[model samples]
Target: MAEHKDYYALEMKIDQMIDELQGLCSQNGLSNTAAEEVVVTSVFLYKFLSDKYMHNIEKFAEEIGESVDEVLANENDELDAFYDAYPTDVVFHSTDTIQALINKSGQPGFAAMFDDTLERISNYQENDKFKVSTAGGEKEPLFTRITENIIDKSKRDAFAVAIFGIISESKFDFSDAFGGNFDFYSTIFEYLIKNYNVASGTYAEYFTPQSVSSIISKILVGMSQVDDNKLYDVLDCAAGSGSLVLHLANELGHGKFGNRARVYAQDVSTKSTRFLRLNMMLNGLTESLDNIVQGDSLTSPSQYNVNHDPSSGYKKFDYITINPPFKMDFSATRDEIESNWQDTDRFFAGVPKIPKKKKESMAIYLLFIQNVLWALKDNGRAAIVCPTGFLTAQSRIEKKIRQRLIDENWLKGVVSMPSNIFANTGTNVSVLFIDKTKGDDDKVILIDASKLGEKRKEGKNQRTVLRDNEINQIIDTFINQKAEDDFSVLVSTKDIKKKNYSFSAGQYFEVKIEYVEMTEDEFNQKLSGYVSDISRLWNEGHQMEAEIKKDLGGLIYERK
Candidate 1:
């Protein structure tokens, strides 16, 4: 599999390149290390795109209805020269104007060259006919926020030279490395996010541990029947770096959905959108890049409206998934959401109460849950990562959401996962599966997987790592609606209602109590032993008290 490729080598090379870039940035007085990383990585992406273009020259030419050599002859002479001497340290000359500016090798020159090069490669203004769609998007260029002043001109040349050397001679061919499988790229991106070579954020915003994504993806795909002719629209309303959506796309897209499964990703973070689009490109899912939107998913969802109507907006999606921000202070936008989307169907459960102070703990997940319900088409299934408390909380909104899921019969099941499943947060989480199609089905599968993970510490925070077998077991039990003792149970909606709409597996699972039987003689012997031990301790306590008194008597009193 492509995932087993020598990704370590690529990681090592990228690390080495980043070290050089950072060293140059530090020397050049670039205080904003985060911006430096972003700009440099953006340049690296462009280099990869350019290199991929060169390596696949024949294919690209054919797609554009041109002869390969003819197309190559018309390409930028400097890029062509650099490609010719690639994989070697041979010095190459470039006739391109950007190269001329860089040759000046000063602050202004480097900035000018950097700006021109990025625009030429990404914006494709230099040659409109030959454009890499990755960079020519309607949204602002991914690195538009990167200003030329980020690094000094002298440092810019060093950065440029280091980046050029790394890209030109590197053995990593992203296309060949990816080999049509995105998992390897996804892992590499995760590694980058960890190393802080990508956007700056809490790691949780960029990564959903593969174990979690794996479980969600497997369960979601297993529960849904894929139709080869149907285009499954997979959405991650809070798609942090696009891990969940990409996993779903890779897993479900290959089966009956084929390439027909389009991905819709939205995140409120601009940095997240950048990482997400790069993830999609790395996975060769650049076709769906446009669907990755940057905006507040709650108040201003940029994709198809969650509240879709026949007369106006796009159709509802076939599948929806999200691991939304567990808690956020949406007080700023609360008025807008409440005033505009007052329909009970939107925030059907109830809006989280606006706390006057310290509103960061507001239960945004409830609203996301409602959004998922609205976004999904009839018969659609959604697997959402939620705080485990949501399943059992007596809070008004929390209970209302659970009750509605039960009464409306939208909930398929709830898997109570172990605490620290997410390394970034300690909140115990659960994967709530809601199937609109299964509304008529009374049984709701509740699995207590809270104890199923291998307990381990990840840095300061603890996490539960679910093995492949355990993941599969959870999926199987839920999909087959199998009720096992102490592990999972299939409870009817009636039973759930009786339990006050509590989806907690513990609430329904029968607790078994075991007792050991003993004869009269055995009980008497055990009782006697306990009595003797207690008597001995009593005597010892008296003797210790006497010894303390004697020791005090030995001390001389110094009276003032």
Candidate 2:
């Protein structure tokens, strides 16, 4: 109970900080735009890093029987040696400390000083791994000159000052929260990006809800037989903000196992990559920061080794999770992918053809599905979020993919999620699980959880939120392969092939017909009532037909 109260207090403080920062943006005329999001998130991150740096120093001081003030008073060489010995995830210089910045807040050119400090910290040599790399071989640092976004140079100073004031007043201490579970940090991450994740452009950013992420992680990890002593690699090809992959890491015993899993993620959105980096740091997965690549996973997958004698392109992973963009206008790169990737066999199921109209409606998720299949090892496991329509698709790339899964006996199971599960879009979705270790005789578990969540109004849309018990129920059923009447079914690959490779649970469920016993006298009475009603209806129809004929015959035709 005390732990819950402490977490609630931290949540309130974080929420207050975000609200104040956004309000400051409004006062400075940078509200509800890309600039506002960048400035607010960056400033918030600066404060977090500052607090975390101080927390580390405090802990180190206690371990060595030294005061924090003594450590802060150390010269450049002494401080560098201390950091080298301690080996913290983030490095902070004496001049880059928040106290130094606070002392200089009243000085002239304070805004420039602030921007310079953030830039220096981002460009520090020790922090090189934190930089996100693009497909063009360019690295993006953590922070930019965010104050420049304010058009009025005069207000820039006030803007920076107000941001510092808000952060200092709130005094965020993430020390206790870091020891908390994934739910604690996930809540903060979601709240941080809720406003920016709404509808954007052709590439709409779909942040997978926590319920869906939890279900995927729980089932994927629960069903797999993992070795506690071994280190594993996990990937999320279309990781938006890293929620799915983070949950999977936690399930794999992240903190307890001491970096037991290395998380590799790639996404096409720069904004999402930034958010993903923050999430990794917040969750104590700092070792995986170098694996976070910001590029088009389809056109140029950067998570491969090219330095070996024979380049091992598209590194295979032990586990994979994906929530790819359902549809996008990849028409620009469709031809490039076809011409370049033919030898790789990455798109074994083939790509969606460009339509004459509405090219944006092309099903790009098919490519992601095929990519996941190619990236998995012989005994690997994966879970993918797909449109519900993909389950029952009878032809084209969708059917071909399902056919491959069934023919190879790699399909594990599928769960149909509730409608409006994602508050941003109303399209229903399903999770497709794959396990390469399954044999031909293994039956697939199909669950229809579409009717399990409660409906609630979220902003302008109605969202279906799954309760804790409902999520647990779905996970338990899938992991144990339990077949419930009308809700779930366990089917063999032979039966799946007979059904034209459809993965929908409803198709496999039995259509039960109830029979009742009755006496001969009761049956006769029921038959007589049915015959009388039919006879009366037939007589009424004949009378109506005669009346219609007479009315038509009495009418006279006239031309005007």
lDDT of each: 0.70, 0.85
lDDT of 2 by residue, 189-209 (tens): 888888887565312264788
Per-prediction backbone clash count: 1, 0
lDDT of 2 at 536: 100
Error of 1 at 125 (Å): 7.8
Q: How would you encode candidate 1's per-residue C-alpha lDDT over 1-560 as one tens digit per residue? A: 13444666665665565566556556566635667657656755665565455555555566667776675567575346444543221111232222344355445455456566566444543233122122223354644434454534445556655445444544344544535446667656675556452233334657888877877888888887777777778889888788888888877765453476688888877677777877776776765765766777787666774345666454477788788888889888887887778854778767887898889888888899999988888878888999887877898888887888888898888888888777777788889988888746798899999888798875555778888799889878887889999999888999999888888899898878998799999999999999999999999999999999887777744331
Candidate 2 colliding pairs: none
State TM-scores per candidate. Answer: 0.80, 0.94
Residue 95, candidate 2: alpha-carbon lDDT: 82
Tell me which residue pairs clash in candidate 1: 107-153
Error of 1 at 15 (Å): 4.8
